[model samples]
Target: MSNVSYYTAEGLKKLKEELNQLRDVERPLASQAIAEARDKGDLSENAEYDAAKEAQGLLELKIAKLEETLANARLIDESQLDTSKVLVLSTVKLRNKQNGMEMKYTLVAESEADLKSGKISVTSPIGKGLLGKKVGDTASISVPNGTLKFEILEITRN
Candidate 1:
């Protein structure tokens, strides 16, 4: 069975758009490239044909992966989320217990993780440790560097 993924309404919409782009645009473009390459010369000796075939295979693999992700995705209702604890799609404010540094992040599905936007995957070490924690609660997370502690300052659905 495929692992279920939790996504907010906006996240789900973005996923759907990406899937559509891959199927409607990239797939057709790949097919066209293969056809164009095939017309150039013999299949065995043509480098262009070989390259195009490899590209087509990769594109199809990507499409299949995206389709699987969509099949297992579950759209979460933000309104139904409780602000009392950190969970998927929760925007959390935290303070480093060891160094007093403050940081904020939103927990999202792996597909939606974007460090530039301060969104972290729920499967990540910090995100996993923060889940189910409430404001004023402390979480000790194990990371590649070492174990770090964080104090939750706030949790809100975004």
Candidate 2:
């Protein structure tokens, strides 16, 4: 099962940076901790050794997962995208139908989604609803609260 994900250039760079940090900095630290713990006492009776071993295992698992994610990651070209409709990496400006409140969001990959940064995952309820919509198109999105309506004001590939 191969799960491919799309990301902007900046998002891909950030992912690579995190993977490098985990592999270069974190992996060595974990190994060092395990070695120091082993020098303390017998492995069977040493709680520090057990804890260190467990921590190393967890760190290795995280590194493996991150490696998998990076292996399947693809970088999207903003210039190649069509701004006529909402799509991955599309910065969409929306208007709330009821209140006329304007909001902007950048549709991104699941791992890159950050609400505080105005970036949303394409798999999210609002993102999914907004997908394939053109300017002035109304999207009825179902959320945890209920269905909410939004009008697509503009789509920019940035």
Candidate 3:
């Protein structure tokens, strides 16, 4: 079964662009490398040829995975998202219960997760715990060290 993921227009476009780059540019480069390596010497004794073949195999696997991901991706309409609670694509303002520190994060797909830009994957520990939480709701998220509590201050569609 294919796992379907939802993405905003920008994210979907980025995925398509990456898929195209892999197929059009990376695939040819892998093939060319294989050809060059094959011309070097005996197939059984050539380390370069073996390495090139392994690289090509890995490249093909990556391409296949990307293709499958693109096939299962769906574009999300941001305008239709609800702002009543923390949800996928919702920009949530949270206050760290223990430290009194405030931070904001946009819940996004796994592929689009970027901590620096405050976009987190919905599957992440904090994001998972924040799902369906309304304003003022406190979510206790478990991390590698310990459980941290975050109070949802606000939720908005961005």
Candidate 4:
């Protein structure tokens, strides 16, 4: 099954850059380390050769996984996004019903989520709860502690 993921233009660019770094820079470094270790002595008795081979295997696995992710990634056009309701890339302003505290968050792909920057994964509990919500809509989300209610104050596309 293809696990397709959506990303903004910037997010997609970052993913591509990371894949390139892994393939171009790290791959060659791993190969060089393995070559140096192989030239030392017998393969069975050499611990350095064994470790280098293991490291190279892990690096190759990482590269393959990244390539697969890039293949399944779809770039989202911010200009074409609808602001009528909450969806991916929507910047939502929420108000906590219990404490009247207000906060803002941008719904993004899982790989692009950064809580410090107010970007949240769409699959997260709060993000799922807020999905498709409109202004003045209340979202009752179940968390580890308890159910927290949030009032959707506004939704906009940035």
Candidate 5:
């Protein structure tokens, strides 16, 4: 079964680039390593040759998985996204109900999530809780530590 994943245009492009780099650069290197190791001694007794072959097999598996991911990837148009409610690709401004600390986070695909950049994956606990919530709505999210409350202050398409 194919697992379809949604990504922004930029995220899709990055995935393609990474796939290209692995196939073009890393694949060749793996092949070269195997060849060099094979030339050293008899295959049965050569530990280096065995290690190189194992590494090559791992690299091929990685390449195949990336190809599958690319095949199932879909691009999401940010312009068509609704801004009134929290959703994938929504930049939300929130206030912590307990401490009143205001913060901002952009909901994005799992591959694009970067906490330092304030982008959280839609499948995350906070993201799941914030989904479908509108401005002025309070979201009580259950986390590993405890349940935390956040007041939605604004939602934008940025």
Candidate 6:
């Protein structure tokens, strides 16, 4: 069974763009490569043709995966999001209780997770730990290294 995927508006847009590129550009290019390889030599022992066919198969697989993701995606309503507690699409500011270090992160879908941009996957340990916690609440999360505690400082939609 295919699990339904929840995506922010931006994430859904990105998936649509990728699907367009695959259908219009990559698919045609793959077909052209296969045709060119087929013209090179006999099909029985043609190495180029075999390689091109393999590449085309991989391209089709990618296209299929993207299509499936798009079909299963549900856009999240950004306007309806509440900042009362940590939730998906919420930007949370936290202070480490053990080391007094401050950090901020936005909880997002797995596909939208980019640590460099401070977007964390909702399924991630830290994000999971912070979920449903209000300001002034302390969360104890288990990390790969060890257990760490964080105090929720603030929550915002942005």
Model 3 TM-score relative to the real fold:
0.94
Best by TM-score: 4
| Candidate 3, number of clashes | 0
Estimate the TM-score of every prediction. 0.93, 0.96, 0.94, 0.97, 0.95, 0.94
For model 6, residues 1-158, the per-residue Cα lDDT tens digits are 89788899889999899889988998899899889988987999999889889988998899899999988888888789888998899999999999999999999989999999999998999989999999999999999899999999999996
Clashing pairs in 2: none
Worst 10 residues of 1 by lDDT: 7-16
The clash count of every prediction, one per candidate, is 0, 0, 0, 0, 0, 0
Once fitted onto the true fold, the runs of candidate 2 whose alpha carbons sit more than 4 angstroms away are: none
Q: After superposition, how far is residue 112 of candidate 3 from its true place, in Å?
A: 0.6
lDDT of 6: 0.92
Predicted candidate 3 versus true structure: per-residue lDDT over 1-158, tens digit per residue: 99999898899899889889988998898888889988988889989888888988998898899889989998888888878988789999999999999999999999999999999999999889999999989999999999999999999997
Scored by CA lDDT, what does every candidate get?
Answer: 0.92, 0.93, 0.92, 0.94, 0.93, 0.92
In model 2, state the lDDT of residue 100: 94
Q: Residues 1-158, candidate 1, lDDT per residue (tens digit)?
A: 79999988788899899989999999899999999999997999999989989999998999899899989999988888899999898999999999999999999998889999999999999889999999999999998899999999988776
Question: Across residues 20-127, which tens digit of lDDT does each residue of candidate 2 receive?
Answer: 999999999999999999999778899998998999999999989989999999999788899899999999999999899999999999988999999999999998
Candidate 4 residue 107 C-alpha distance from true site, Å: 0.5
lDDT of prediction 3: 0.92
In Å, residue 51's CA in model 1 sits off its true spot by: 1.1
Tens-place lDDT per residue, model 4, 65-133, is 889999999988888888878999999999999999999999999999999999999999999999999
Q: Against the hidden true structure, what lDDT does model 2 obtain?
A: 0.93
What residue pairs clash in candidate 3, if any at all? none
